[model samples]
Target: MEEAEAEEQQRFSHRQRLKAAVHYTVGCLCQEVALDKQVQFSKQTIAAISEVTFRQCENFAKDLEMFARHAKRSTVTTEDVKLLARRSNSLLKYITEKNEEIAQLNLERKAKKKRKPEDENRDFMELDADVVGSDS
Candidate 1:
C-alpha cells in the first residue's frame, strides 16, 4: 500500500512539473517583450520549466534577443508583451462573426422553404374552387 501511494505521488509530481513547464513556455512565447526585459529570469530558468522542444524554445528566445539587440533596448517592456497578447481577441471575434452569418443564412433558407409551400397551396386551392364553381 505504501509503495503504491509513493508511485501515485511521483506521478502527480511529474504531471505538475509538466504543467508548469507548458504554462511558462506559452507565457514566455506570448509575452516575449514584457518578460524579456521586465522579468528577471535566466534562459536556463526558462528552459528548466518549459515542455517545448529545444528548437522551438530556442527560436523564440532568439527572436526576442534579436529584437532587443536591434532596438538597442536593454529591457523588454509592457509594449513588447502587448505585441504577443494582441492575438488573444481576434480568434474569438472571427468565430462570432461566422456564427452570426450562419444564423442569418439558416433563417433565410427556412423563410424561402415556407414561402414555396404556401404559394403552391394557395394556387392549388384557387384552381379547385374554380373547378367546383364551373361544375355546379
Candidate 2:
C-alpha cells in the first residue's frame, strides 16, 4: 500500500511539472499590463486567459491544417489564416484591410522597379536633347 501511495505521489508531481511547463507566461505579462489600467487580476484570471489562449491556438492550428487539406494543398497560406480570423467580424475586417494594404505595397514596389530603368533612359534622352540643341 505504501509503494502504491508513493507511485501515485510521483505521478501527481510529474503532472504538476507538466502543467507548469505548459502554463503560458504571456498571460502573466498581460495581467501585469492590466495592473497599469487599475485592474486587479487574480490567479484565476491569469489561469483563465492562459487556458483560453492555449485552446484558441490549438483550434486555429487544427483548422488551418484542415483548410490546407480541403484545398488539396500541402502548405497553408495567408488565405487560410484570414479565413480562420473571419470567425470574428472585427478581426476579419482588420485582416482584410491589412492584406489589401500589403498587396498595394507590393504593387507599388513592382511599379517602382519597372520605372527605374525608364526614368534613367528619359533623363539621358533629355540631357542628350539639351546638349544637341545647345550645340546647334
lDDT by residue (tens digit), candidate 1, 32-134: 7656667565566556546456455556567666667667997754344444335668755665667678789999999999999999999999999999999
Q: Rate the local accuracy (lDDT) of all candidates.
A: 0.70, 0.85
Off by over 4 Å in 1: 1-87, 133-136
* Each candidate structure's count of clashing pairs: 2, 0
Candidate number with greatest lDDT: 2
lDDT of 2 by residue, 38-120 (tens): 77777787778777766777688899999999999989988998989987999988988998999999999999999999999
Weakest lDDT window of 10 consecutive positions for candidate 1: 77-86
Q: Which stretch of 10 consecutive residues in model 2 shows the poorest summed lDDT?
A: 18-27
Best by TM-score: 2
Model 1: colliding residue pairs: 21-49, 37-76
Q: Which residue pairs collide in model 2, if any?
A: none
What RMSD value applies to candidate 1? 16.6
